[model samples]
Target: MTGWLDRAAENAHKFAQRNPRAVAAGVMFSLAGFAATAFGVASPSAPGTEIAQQIISEDVQPLPVHEQLEALAAHQLELNRSTAGRANDTADRLLSRLGVNDASAASFLRRERGVRDLLDGRVPRLFTARADESGRLKELVVRMPAERRDQITTHFTRVTLHPAGHGGWKVRREQAQLESQVRLGSGTVRNSLFTATDEAGLPDTIATQLSEMFSEEVDFHREIKKGDTFSVAYETLTADGEPITWNEGAGHLLAAEYINRGRVYQGMWVRDAMGRGAYVGMDGQPKQRSFLASPMEFSRVTSGFAMRMHPILQTMRAHQGVDYGAPVGTPVRTVGSGVVDFAGWRNGFGNVVEIQHDGDRSTLYAHLSRIDVRKGEHVEQGTRIGAVGATGWATGPHLHFEFRIRGVHQDPLQVAKATQTPMASVSRAELQQLATSARTQIAAARSMGAVRAE
Candidate 1:
């Protein structure tokens, strides 16, 4: 008998090796029969088991890949039902621990219904529950929806639990703290202040602030010259030893200084009386002048004050002033503090304004389209007196700027020279000390390659 059983076992093993699929089917059928028999259900051979046999028998067909995927998906859905219910229960428990009542908890769950949409698609789903060292549920994360990554990330709102001493959790919005630093360098310009500031790594917002600071002295669009240069000290946003710049919105104007030509133009960021940001001079005065030095930012001098034949009139005219060829309505300014002595139309000089200064000095602006200041009105240095226009015996819109000494007309361009205010004797010592410190700082910055000369 033992020998016969061994031969049967060998034949079965060989059959399995030859037809693995049929063997697997037979094993499945045997498992089904055993399960029925073990459960004490009626067997196929037992009397009065016809009803059970009919119930168990069915016509089965092989399913395609798509159908098989659908079946697996349905089974996964059944499993996820329990998971989803558990998640909802967990969310409820979390909310309850956070002091939310039943009504509020329901509303909160409704608000988070979007989390359910994650399971409806054919994508893979992963659920992870995080716990503290004490095995308390600290967090639950359900990663899904590649497109909603950012949105889901934002939903990771934190709920702080009261110290373990307390019985429940206290929920609150989470916030992150940020800190930054900046180091601004300086540069010079041979053209416009706007262009130069851009080249110096300063943003438009900072450059605009700098322009506003010196608007009274420098006409950004008109008065800048080729030999004019500037120096600035400022700061930039930094993090982890790297500088940062924003493409939109004003970043920051830490601090800045500018020196145009030989004039020391300085400005620092400050809060105004109304608590608004602004740039003001070191002396707390506005850096702006009333008017600009020239009608054009950079233009060549075509005519000077001398005897010359009038181009259109065909007569030798004693040209008492210099001609600045600029566009129409180019502004004319008083070179120094003075009072308007005359502002009206003249026979040879079009619409003109004459400003009488101290020390028997005066200035005349002729061939103007409009006069801004009235006679007897006090005008400061660089104050706009009129607009350039061909209102008199002139050929084009150009400012006829004249300088006079005791009523004798002289060349305006040559008479005016760059002058520095004399420092008081007491202030001179302080200035020298400041200059020494500045030199040292500037030298160090240069050695470290923090500054570049023009």
Candidate 2:
């Protein structure tokens, strides 16, 4: 113990022996003061009046206020911007909108191999161009807003077009100088899919995309029940240079998920190790199936494949095809890539278009009023082969669709569901890596109302 503390303790011992209660109280108070001092607390040793009498006070004057001179800011120059019209699918129209009067430049842009997609109908855009007084475009900037997760441009990428030497034009790509924002949307399925998505303030296009994404796992047409919920995480585009962007609608839907009757399905756009993108599942499986959805865009199934009493024949027989009732001359589409096997008449089947697809599978479309494809000609999926009609086997106007595996008939509904192919291994792994972001997006989508990204 310190010498001062020891002396104090000795004095306290003496006080304790004389009056223990007074000593105990004084010890507690002393300990409290000691503790306060230890904690850097200012313990006043003298009374307020004594301290005030011994202290002096003084005040300093404030610094003099001064006016500072500053230079005026310059105004930003606005780019001359114009929109490509609906009929602007051609290079002439595109150059015209950009105020380019040069005919050779227009022809160059039209015939250039690399610029076809920029000039296509799918990505029609407004142009920000620098033109001369004579109406010759010195430079052109076209904004390509990201539309899909696997797309080339992530944010707002620009395609800058300019004149090259030798009276020719060249194109250069500009990185995304624009900002991208994330947003959320959520809703539970109630009466209909559109109603539920609309209630969540989601775009109809996004809802449709979500349905197509999850079609392999959930049947949106019949399996969707009440209380099933869906959520989406998407992006919006903006720019510092242009306050008003030509981009419309929500951009790429980065991630989406669904909880249908206690089962969960998620889809996230993931870029593989090779930098290729695909929508994948949590288990690293490629989930999207590219197939012709339905032969008839809109129709009612008047007759299905089953054994029934034939309308023309008296005896009950096996009905080998599904009949879709439509108008007299509705366009029928080929469901898959194949060669036309027989685009001619049969005994019971009228004008038929039989397609020989891979894996010994063939699709037959019968009762067509007219045929557009010739036998032995290759026809891609979604090709207009013929029009639906009642040409043979006495009946009303209906499309007789049949799916055959090695000549054995299979149900059309089952065929459609079995056609989905898993993506490659690289894409699957790439998609799995995006699980973390995808899950976070789903959470955001579930928690918030529709929020646009800035």
Candidate 3:
């Protein structure tokens, strides 16, 4: 019997070697069955057996009143305030308004020449101050326009005052570079362009650019009806992330869209290889015409080129030119690039300046307080040749602008519209990309304006 058992074991070992995978599967099946049987036979608890639970409660006590008061006293807060310097602002008054009662800071501000200069300008300067809980000034900063005329747009002046190592004070005055920030704005014309821009918080410079951008399509002076809308994306110069006041932080107008009388106009700024940039339509055509509709940057048309009662003559006569009502000394520019044909006092037109352009076209600017150009001088479009004045046979300050074709009087607005805007050869792909970006920005600005209105 022992020999027969040994022979059977030998046979089983040989079979396992021949079929290893089958042997492994059988072993796993047997283990699973064993586990199922063990679980099935597990003993059950006694009938009606139950667990127990108990509730616990206690009151938490805070620290003593004196300890709490000490903790509160250890944590002191600092306050910051900012305001613009007023014309009548004294050191003490300014400090008081900023919630600082420190006499030393006020004394320093008055005693330091640099600090006093920061507050001397008629235009307000931005002032920022920091103080402790006891109203003691810890730091003061003043920001204003750069003193250099060439750097006003590119730089800003910063004056700082703080406590030194000791109880004394340290002052610093420096010029910092201005940073350009891209901004978007949109508005609707309810009354006038200025009023709409004021409501929209847009800079006056940008508002003027918008008018110039679509001068050929619409007459901003007379044809701007109610319900007209516009959107703009522009660059604003900032000093340390704060918008500067001088020049209203004026920069470049990047892109603009205007809707007037159910007509839509859009333009995007495109630069050439020479680094010169201009506003162009989505089709890669320039928008700036050779002539501008208005001689001045922005003004109202007091009289049109038609029959009107002469203020001085007191007789109905044909008004050969358009009269623009503006304040005295308002800058008057040449409508188109040309040479000064005449620059002097005339019979009815005082301080007159006539510019002769190509194609037998000439423009006239009269009633000037001062003449900045001379006869035979070459002047470009938008060049300030003189200023608005009442020197001519006029009752008030205004600009008399006229456009002549072959010695014949023509409407200035009409002439501007008829003049063709020269288109420059540009890369179609580049212009299309720029126009696409401008469209996105303009849409965002419009949506933002709608949200604000809501």
TM per candidate comes to 0.29, 0.38, 0.55
Error of 1 at 223 (Å): 35
Ranking by lDDT: 3, 2, 1
Number of the top lDDT candidate: 3
> Please, what is the whole-model Cα lDDT of each candidate in the order they appear?
0.47, 0.60, 0.68
lDDT measured at residue 62 in model 3 versus the true structure, 0 to 100? 13
Candidate 2 residue 114 Cα shift, in angstroms, is: 15
Writing each residue's lDDT as its tens digit, candidate 2 over 1-454 gives: 1332343345445435744443333321221101010000011122242222122110100011000001111121232546653544677877676666877667777778877677767654556777776767777777665443223233555788788888877788765644333445666777877677776556554565577567668877678889788877665444423322343443445578888898988886543223333456767566745356468888888777676789988789878878899997899999988789999898778989999875456899998999999999998888999999888884788899998865878667544643444244343333444566577657645543222110
Q: What stretches of model 2 exceed 4 Å from their correct place?
A: 1-77, 80-82, 86-123, 131-138, 142-185, 188-190, 195-206, 225-227, 234-254, 261-264, 269-280, 285-432, 450-454
Q: Give the local distance difference test score of model 3.
A: 0.68
The 10 consecutive residues of candidate 1 with the worst lDDT sum are 31-40
What residue pairs are clashing in model 3? none
Name the better of 2 and 3 by lDDT. 3
lDDT of 3 by residue, 1-454 (tens): 1232233345445435754543443421111000010000001132211110000000001123224334644653247777788888889888888889887888877887767776675865888888988998888888888866446666888888897745578988899977654566777788987678666667766776666567667777688779888877776776765667777675656678888887998886654433244557767778756677688888999988776799899999989988999999999999888899999999889789999975456899988999999999999888999899999798999999998865878777645543434235445555665677677657656655554444
Better of 1 and 2 by lDDT: 2
Give the Cα-based TM-score of candidate 1 against the true structure. 0.29
Candidate 1: RMSD over Cα atoms?
A: 35.1
